[model samples]
Target chain A: MKKLYTLIKNDLKLIVRDKTLLSFLLLPPVLIIAFKFLTPILVETAPILEEYRVIIGMFASIQTAIMFGFVTSFLILDEKDENVMNVIRILPISGFYFILYRLLFATVFSSIAAYAMITLSDIAHPGNLEAILLAILYGMTAPTISLAISTYAKNKVEGMAYFKGIDLLLMLPIASFFVGSSLSMVFSILPTYWVFHFYETSYNDAPAFEFFAVGFCFFGILISLLLFQFRKRVFGR
Target chain B: MIHTKDLYFKYPGAAQNTVNGISFDVGAGEIFGLLGPSGSGKSTTQKVLFKLLSGYQGSAQIKGKEITDWGKELYSQIGVGFELPNHYLKLTALENLAFFQSFYDEGLDPMELLKMVGLEKDADKKVGEFSKGMKMRLNFVRSFAHNPEILFLDEPTSGLDPSNSRILKDIILDLKNQGKTILITTHHMEDAEELCDQVAFLSEGEIKKLDSPENLKLEYGKRTLEVRTYGSNEPVIFDLDQLKDDKSFLELVQSGEIKTIHSKEANLNDIFIATTAKK
Candidate 1:
């Protein structure tokens, strides 16, 4: 627990010091604020946002998952680039524990953003436990997928390209919302599809499947990353 | 506490081993230098000993066991101060040390270590703001934070001014006096001379020569004497083949006209060239 705290603290310190990363982290909240007001104006004319206000809030929350994922991957990559990981690997604790802490940072921060967006966007009841919990799950897994993609990124610039290229995958689950249930299976192949599906199905009938789907997506992304590490040497083995 | 026998390491998919069939030992409380130019496997050997590179043939032992056998516990006993001085650029010097200190449960006081390296004043300053020399000094004492019995210092004094180098050397000697074993790998032969109790000259992944600096000088040194007279601007060299019967040499010395007279022996650079053949 102490080691995890120290690692998380260290990561936070690094993120705060890095201007590029700080901006990425701050972007979600700023956009949520901008969208909070602009969204009201847009809903007046656009009939779609009035019915899909929860999705609009989900958009703000989900952007955090994307940003945090980029932050997590590049943070790990930066450690390698600076060769500090070599110093870190020799620490008394297992180096793999640091990866856990990074993932912890990802999920925790994304959850906070989800809750924060839900409250600020005023699209739903902030006290809605199931809705906020679903928001958190959706927020958490997007970065988890991004984190997995970053593991394959050879360097920072490549990590950025990977982040941008895979950014489209996050919208797939949301896009499936308008296209009807026929496209749901295709999007469900992506881990993020479960997250978007949970939000889409949360207000209507059959909330239990959507809830299980989100959990499955979160664990699925993790299990696949575990398999990746097992099959190939990574983190500079 | 370090011993290697027939050590060999080849990177993945490489044609040949970077460190091939080499061996050496560094005893407790001794400074052993691994000397070589780039691509000669000095770094590779250090990496193998430090367990940074594995999958090598032969043996490297730390504290009576194979290097690979020792894990995180091995790190506790063996400290490393790298050449380039990597640190969290955002963290203050104190924060960085304290952060690393959290990784070790044993004896450590980050402030004292910082003060020992004259970095206590800049303890609050971010490492990114530090000069290169300050960074190097901070890195040198970082090894001390873990209270390791053996230290693996890769080019300990790589990019420091003479004064800072002397300061660092003095601190290393202090550690030696306190019974810490240190292994230093450097291309600076003079560093090997001044610091190492024994030095190994490596070339093309093989040990070309291994001896104390003094012994190497004696073995490869020129067996000659030179003297300068008041009239001559240049010294006259004479072989020590029959020094007693050399009439002119004796006359110049006896007449007290010899401006300087000393045996011509090898400095470390001279011996380095003689052994490594200017590779």
Candidate 2:
């Protein structure tokens, strides 16, 4: 427990020191706000402005998640490239605990970024406790997927490549303006797509418990297993 | 303590074993050095000892039990300082130490360790701003912050200037005095000569020679003296063994004209090069 606290503290210190955190955490939401203001200028029609607002807002949320996910991957890759992983590997700590510490750190950062985006856009405020809980749940999924991707990357450069490719595909559902709304059903399998769905659906009314619970359980199980396999294959006993 | 017998390790897709059948033992409070050139399997041997690589043929015992039998408990008693500095550059030096020190159930005081390595003044400075020598100095003390009973140090002084190297050497010797068994791997012959009580010369996945520095030198050295004397305004060299009991040799010595005399004993470097070069 002491070790976990130390790891989390050190991770937080490092994150705070990074100059890129501002661009990563704040820039996406700022860009979304800018787009929201410029929507009328780009499209003088109210119908087009409404469509643009929804598309930009959805894109903003996913951009936030992907940005935060990439940050987590870069951090883990940096540790691996610097041989910090090897140093910790020789310690008395279990692999499970090591990864848990990283996951916790990433989750905290991603949550902050997610909340900032939600506030800036003022689009979908999940006011109730259940809605808020689901938002937090959505935020936690990004880091787990990021950790899984990092396991396959050999270095920072490769990690960025993987992040870019994966982020591009994951961000596709938000491109509904260009790709057509017919594709949303196809892309809904992606976690970010579900995040957008949950955000849009929650404001109308509390989502059906079955919808949130089932989606949460499925992604949760998948991420848990991915985290386990990543720990075993990349960081062997 | 460490014991390995017929240990073998081959990298995936490699044609031959990186570490062939090699056996050695490190007793309590001993400094054992594995001396070799680059790609000579010195690092591989150390990796196996630390259980970093598996799929080896043979057995290794640490602290009187098979290494495979030891669980997470083994790591609490061992510390490893890698050749490359492994630190979070964005973190202050103290933060880095504090972070890693927390991983162990038993950890040394970070302040005392930082002070020992002369990093106390810069404890709050980010590690990215540190020079290579300073980084190495910090890395040296970082390994011991867990108060490990055994240590594995690879090229402990590779990047340091003479003064910093001396400081690190003193710390290593101090660790020895405190009864911690250490295994050091390096291509630096002088480091091995000065620090290691017992060293093995490795080449091409095998040990060419293993013994104390003094013993290896005695075993491979000529054991004869070469004398230089002035003969007709020119220096003449003669082996001491060749002039034994000769009247001329006695006359030259009695006349007090010997310019220089040196024993033909080899230094550790000479022995290391000679033994490894043969393979």
Tell me, by TM-score, which candidate is best. 1
What's the true lDDT of residue A20 in model 1? 88
Q: What is the two-chain DockQ of model 2? A: 0.69
- Tell how far residue A89 is off in model 2, in angstroms: 1.4
Per-residue lDDT over B1-279 for candidate 1, one digit per residue giving the tens place of the 0 to 100 score: 899999988988999888889988889899998887788888888888877777889999998999878877888888888988788888999998889888887757888878776788999999989998999998888877878999989888888898888889888998998999999988788778988899998887889899999998888888899888888999899888879899988887779887778888787888767667654
Where model 1 places Cα greater than 4 Å from the true spot, the runs are A26-38, A54-58, A115-133, A142-161, A178-189, A207-223, A226-234, B277-279
Candidate 2's C-alpha runs over 4 A off are A26-45, A51-54, A108-137, A152-162, A175-189, A193-229, A232-237, B105-111, B230-246
* Model 2 / residue A133 / CA error / Å: 7.1
| Residue-wise C-alpha lDDT for candidate 2, range A55-172, written one tens digit per residue | 5555666666566666677777778877788877787767567666667666665666666655555544555554455556556667655776778888877876787777787667
Candidate 1 CAPRI level: medium
For model 2 the local lDDT of residue B45 reads 85
